[model samples]
Target: MVLTLTTFLLTLLSIPLLQKLYTLFYNAFLHPLRTFPGPPYVWTDWYKCYNDVYLNRNWTDVLKELHEKYGDVVRVGANELHFSNPSVYNDLYSPTHRWDKDGALYRVFNQDESSFGYLTYREAKARKDILAPLFSHRATCEMQGIVKKHLDRMCEALGKREESSDMLFALRSFSLDCITTYCFAKDVHASSAEDFKHPLVEAMDAAVPAIRVLQYFNPWRKLVFGLPPWLAKLTDPNAGARVELQDMLLEQVKEFVEDPKRMEQTSNPTIYHRLLDPSNGPVPSLKSLHDEAMSLFFGGAESSGNVSMLGTWYILQNPSIESRLREELREAWPDLEDMPRLEDLEKLPYLTAVIKESLRLSPSVPVPLPRVVPPQGATLSNHPIPGGTIVGMSLRFVHQSEEIFPDPQTFNPDRWLGPDASSLNKWLVAFSKGPTNCIGQNLAMCELYMAFAALFRRFELVLDGTRSEDLTYSEGFLPFFNPRHMRAFCRPVEA
Candidate 1:
């Protein structure tokens, strides 16, 4: 019996070895990507998971090194390919392309039926039409009041601080408040806090590190999410906050359902007003509504928060950047009491350049946006990619490539200034491109411009010297900066 058991265990162990040998042989000589060059074959997918999930290595840096070693196109995994060519990026991500969002890769996000996680082009397009109008220019203009209220609160709080303040917390508060207000008429008041550490913000920050783990190993999520509330809190204390966010969203939805007329009667009619309206073609199911709300809430909050935080850090690093930006802000709004309209802010060439340059240098979403080739097949950068193959372009590759932007790593808003600026727009995929690009981009831009103009125009700022490592990051779905990195001392400029 002991000898038989040993044989069975050995056979099970040998199965994986045989599978590895098969994969290597197939990838090297029999796969469609057989001719493509890559690093020594060692299970690229597991290597990626180790670096991204375990070591917390920056994926942008990892892909950048691979591109440097293997040229513009490199086979990064058994069935996955990475391209660094900007024109090819335009081709693959363009609306004209047939590439669909990669199902296997996107499944990790755990957002089902939500636009961000939609796998089929038809369903995604249908959903996009329903949600896209809410983020249009007109909608953003209408929503400006909610944005301003939060921005004003943030500036008011920051102005009262006597010591160097942590901009990460403050910026996150502003973003969290803006998004929650947008989702429901209720405001989280994250920005109104003196300490800037709102409970929801703290919970969201705590959950991020663990969420990245579930993103790679998704099956375990079922186990984690299935635990009873009390036990789940013990396992992932922040899990309660995540549930609370969804619960709040559902509660708001319930209000709309209970009294449909209340949508128009509310003090702040939010995105939910349009989504839950009966005149709308078809209302999403209750779970779908929650999924959509949660997706938009995170999208609206985290991306803008990161931009506000990282942009401030970089702008302060260079004295000239601060000088030029402040000059532009002061010129645009001479009286500190007079706030510039969002449209007027858009017209400030230097301010626009600074925002664009910041988005390029440290994009909020700094990871690869993967897409699957269609059954008809297509070629990227002249390399024929067979249908069903997973392919993506890392924004870091396009943004940081010396081939596309000279001195790409260095932050210079001036690069975006002048006749070449229009041409440079082609390579700017910070908010991504084509049909599946970020839905909240217009609103995010408004938040960024408003925050920068409001804060910098009123205060002269300098970074706290001891917090240099704050600029360093570890790879999550979004760039997670060391919270301590963005501390800055501010003084009200003598008008």
Candidate 2:
């Protein structure tokens, strides 16, 4: 009996060793990517799992060094190649390309069939087709009032704060309010909270660290996310928050269903209106509706808020930039008392340049967006990549390519100021490019422009003991700022 128990324990230990041996042998000698140039451990999944999930190393830095050493194309995983060339953006992401989202990697995020998680071409196309109108240029324009209200509240709240405030939390709270307003059809006043620590905002922030854990070992995602309330509260750190957020959103769906005419009656009808409209065909399932709303809330809040907070820090660091931006705003909107229109802000070249540079320097989604190579295979940077392999480019690495943008690490708005700015747009993958790119981009842009215009025009921002490296990110799926050090102090600009 003792021998039998000892044998079982030995077998358990040997299984993983045997599996690792098989993986290493297969990836190094037998895999189709065997010829790809990369670090020895790139052939092993353990390398990726350790760095991305365990250590949370900056892939942007990791991939950049690998590419510089091995040339533009470097193998990052057993079947993955990281491309640094800007010219291949279209080839990889354009609709003509057969490349699709890496199902295995993205599934862990559980986007719930939202646009980001759509694995199949047909499903994504159908969903995008349905929701496209809401994010159209016209729709974004129409939503300016909602965005402006929150921006106003953020500025007001900042003015009220006596001490330095964590801009990351402040901006994230504001963005959550904006997105929740759009999603639920009414503002929850999250930004107006005296301390700017809304429950949903707190929940979303709490969920980020857990994402890395689940993303690496995602077979447990269903079990954990599907946990009963009581069990989830005990086992999952974010489960309570997640439940609360979902319940809030689900209630909005209930509100829409009970009063169909509320879509017309409400000043700002929820996202559910268009989705649930009889003219739009079948209403989405409760889970899909909940999932879609939750996805938007997370995406919208994180992406735009990161841009706003980080951009604010960069602007504050440069007095000349602050002066020039304010001068541009004043020129564009001569009467400070009169609210500036979104169209007017969009036309300001210097302000536009500042926003563009900020995004380039610190894109919210800075990680490698992995897309699977088609079965037919393809060439990237003149190298023939085998089919069924994973290929991607880290936006952080791509945006920082010294070849594409001279002194790429430096934040210079002038790079986006001239006729050259048009060329720069091709490489600006912050919103990504092509059909699979961010759907909320137009709204995000509008928010950025308005927020920058209002904040810079109205207040003078100073970094309250925060260094550039304080905001220097360690990459997760999105850039992660050390929240403790992301503080900024604001003073209202004297008349």
Candidate 3:
């Protein structure tokens, strides 16, 4: 009886072991990507899990090293390949490709019905069309007042700081406030929080790092997101904000779905007007409404805030750069009381160059936006990849390319000033390229432009012992900068 029991246990375990072995064998020898080269265990998805989950190293940084060792293309997962060549970016992510986004990375967000979370080209395109009217350039131009109001409130807080204020948190607060008001007619009022330590902003900062955990072990995402507010607060008090926001969004979605006409009661023309309009098409499910709300908030706030923060830091560090920028701003608006319009700001060549450089240098959404090759298969870097292969190229590969942006590390706005600058515009993939690119970029651009104009023009900034490494971040879906953020003393100027 003892021998039989032992034998049963062995059989049960060996079956899976044998299955794993066969998978490894097939991936190593018979898989479509078999010819691709990477380190051992690359045949298993766990190779990424080990690097991203176990070792907790930056996956993009690891890919950079792998590319250096294995040449331009490296097989990073069983059916996944990553390219380090800048030229391959356009070829793989062409406007016409209409490739599906890889689900492994996107589904972790837990908003699959929303535009950013949609995997198929058709689904995403449909949502994008419905929402395009609200995010059009003209819409953004008209809503400049809302952007400026939040910017003014943020700067007012900075001006009142006793010693120093964190630009990252402050900028993120401004963004969160702007997005909530602009999109939902909900004023989260994150900007009013003392020292910019609002619970939602803190929760968001914490959440960015946690995304690494969700990426490799997605099942845990449901568990993590499913926690009750009290339990979440017990886990981490800041997490309470995340849970609270989820509940609020759920309630708001239900309200709008039940009475679409009630949108007229909102403080502004909220996204509900577009999303719930019958003429646009059928209304989405309740869950989709909530998902779209979260998607728009995150999409609007995070990168814009981070990029503007980057611009502020870079400008403060270089006195000459700041001087040149201030000289231009002063000449453009000699009286501090008379601020220029968004249209006027857009026409400032130096300011435009500075904004472009800021977008170029900031590790805006640093990770690769993964997309699946179509079922018919596709060519990347002139190599034929299988239909189901996962392919991506990090923006770092393109933005920091020395061949394209010389002295890429330096914060020189002059790069965007040259006669050849127009030719380089194709490589500026900050908003990304193609149909699935960021839909709310118009609003984000307006925010970025207004942030720079207001801050540099309204006050003189002095860094408070923030070193270069303080700005450095590890790779998550977003770059995770923590333990230290850029702090500055904002002294209001009267000219």
Candidate 4:
């Protein structure tokens, strides 16, 4: 009787495993996604899909290749669809769409429940509404002096460098210091190695990549979070780094909260002050304020810095383009010390074209902005797409399309200048378009124009023993070129 009971229990245990296998087979052959063309294993295994993404180094390129093979719309994963058609933009990011955020990746990035970084769509929208004014044109204009001071300091720092340092690293520090000062009313001074050595900066950097990885293994995230802080540190260095960063931010917020008079004394408006007033509007918890501030600081800094580096790289590689840019700068501003005001930079047509061209060639955020399809379903390029599908447009592919940008490989800023400039501008979607566009664009542009104007005016940059075509890109959550590996020889130019 005992033997019979044991055998029966073992048989029962095998049933679920068999059922799972059967379901997998059924999905592979009979599911709706099965009808769509993709790699054969995409339907059967998630790991295989991830492997393809990793192997390709850039999943966007893989998506483009698949689209070419299968059609404009291809089932790239079990539930994910890749759309190459421009109309995909409308269906995915449109305000009217009922689709909710499907990617749980944000959850891993969240510092705590009270932080804005973790907040759902409803919360994010509410926060955006309250905070939008702070990043406005008027707001950015008010902050121009603050921006310029930091830029000037950065230029000084670069001038002092004995060896050719990565412009991205220097700019990253500058942007970080600038944003932190605005947000916290205290200078983090991330512009120098000594400043970056501060515990807070080190921790935040470590935590960011950790959170990205943790988001992938969603099943055990809560358990991961629940681990002792020390144990968590062992598992994810980011968690430890995050703890230090958060502690620093919290301390600053506490100081502000304790001294209401201190908050009132600000002549210049900041996002922190705007969010602190309950009657002014719905305010996120102080904790949320801190996280959001950090997010803005890091996001704004890293992206703007990378773009500056890439833009500089492209200009240096093409000497004619560099010379033309300098001529425009000279015409725009005769005196190098007399920095071009924000308004002055705006009127420089060639400079604007150079910025646009650089963004097209190397967007800082090249990854697809992933969005889920709504329940009502949608049409992409006249083809009906089912609801609940994951969809995104690859900016890397879209910007490089030969139809939109003729001779796409060539670095031609004039395509954005001259008579055809307006037509070319219409096709430019580097910062993205519509409601979801980058809020910090004005600030980024201000820094870009200022940096370019300052650097080119003062120094002539040349590639240091490295060919432009031979420079390799390093893959991160953001695409940053290997800065140290690629060097530039800078010769001081006579004013």
Evaluated at residue 222, the lDDT of candidate 3 is 83
Arrange candidates by TM-score, highest first: which order? Answer: 3, 1, 2, 4
Residue range 369-390, candidate 4, lDDT tens digits: 6666667777776767777777
Candidate 3 ranges with C-alpha deviation above 4 Å: 1-10
- For 1-495, candidate 2 gives per-residue lDDT tens digits of 999999999999999999989988998999988887888687866677777666667667677778779987888888888887877776778767646788766787777577777776666667777878888888888888898888889989988888887788788888887887875765777777756777666677767766667776778888867777788778766567678777777787777777877678776756777788778778877777777887787788888888888788777777888888888887777765676788878888899999998888776777777888878888788988898888887776668778878998677898897676798787888987766788888888888898888888887777788887787666657666676747867788755
Give the worst 10-residue stretch by lDDT in candidate 2: 472-481
Model with the higher TM-score, candidate 1 or 4: 1
Worst 10 residues of 4 by lDDT: 111-120
lDDT of 3 by residue, 1-495 (tens): 999999999999999999999998999899999888887889877887788778888888888899999988999999899999999999777898899999899989999999999999999999999999899999988887888889889988998888999889999999999999999888888989988989899988888888888888888888887777788789976788888888888888888888777787987788888888889899898888889999998788788899988898888878989999999999998887778988999999999999999999988888888899988998888899889899999988999999999999899999999999998889999988888999999999998888999888999888899998898887788877856899889999988
**Each prediction's TM-score against the native?**
0.93, 0.92, 0.97, 0.87
lDDT of each: 0.79, 0.78, 0.89, 0.68
- By the TM-score metric, which is better: model 3 or model 4? 3
Q: What tens-digit string does per-residue lDDT give for candidate 1 at 370-424?
A: 8888887887888888987788887877788787689887888889887788989
Better of 2 and 4 by TM-score: 2
Among these predictions, the greatest TM-score belongs to 3
Higher lDDT: candidate 1 or 4? 1
Model 4: colliding residue pairs: 203-241, 207-238
